[model samples]
Target: MGEVKVVFQSVDEVMDYLKALEGYSGDLDLQCDHMIVDGKSLLGILSLGVNRLLNLQIYSDNYEELIKKIEFCCRG
Candidate 1:
């Protein structure tokens, strides 16, 4: 498993992020505090609220390409 920190600034950003995540075949989850949601679900992502950094856990060994695609939202 791999992890990355990302922040969504708006609803549009969340939509875009989910679009980028569509290509991922492995299990992907977005977590904030105690809430965890499916990374690919638009509603799930939006439920976490925006403009705050969140933890993304990617459960796959070949996730480098997926990471690169979503790196635009990565927080440092």
Candidate 2:
């Protein structure tokens, strides 16, 4: 398991991240307050009310690449 901290600026970025994550075969988890959702779910991510200081956990052999892709959204 790997953990990364990131902030989402908009819904579009989140959608992009989700799209990129479609290629990853891993268990990705995003947590905000007490809510936990799949990192690959656009609807699930949007419902978190994520704005800043969101911690994402990418679990799998490809976690390093997944983290990089998700970090891409922080800039968007």
Candidate 3:
């Protein structure tokens, strides 16, 4: 699994992030504290709240491309 911390600035950013995930075939998860949800689900992401650093667990080895595409939302 690949892990990276990210934060969404707005609903629109979340939508864009989801769109980026569509290209990946492997399972993905979003973790906030002890809670974990499917990264592909808008409701799951919304439930985690926006503008907060959340861990993105991409279940794939070839996730660099997706990461590059979502650089705008990554928590530096």
* Best-matching candidate per TM-score: 3
lDDT of 3 by residue, 1-76 (tens): 6888999999999999988777578888999999999989999999999989999988898878778989989985
Q: Write the per-residue lDDT of candidate 2 for residues 1-76, one digit (tens) a residue.
A: 8888767788777777778777678787878888888877777788887576667887776677766666675432
Runs in model 2 with CA error above 4 Å?
74-76
The window of 10 residues in a row where model 3 has the poorest summed lDDT is 19-28
For model 1, residues 1-76, the per-residue Cα lDDT tens digits are: 8899999989988878878877568998999999999988888888899988899999999778888998888896
Against the true structure, candidate 1 reaches a TM-score of 0.92
- Minimum summed lDDT over a 10-residue window in model 2 is located at 67-76
lDDT of 1 at 26: 94
TM-score per candidate, in order?
Answer: 0.92, 0.82, 0.92
User: lDDT per model, in order?
Assistant: 0.87, 0.74, 0.90
Q: Comparing candidate 2 with candidate 3, which one achieves the higher TM-score?
A: 3
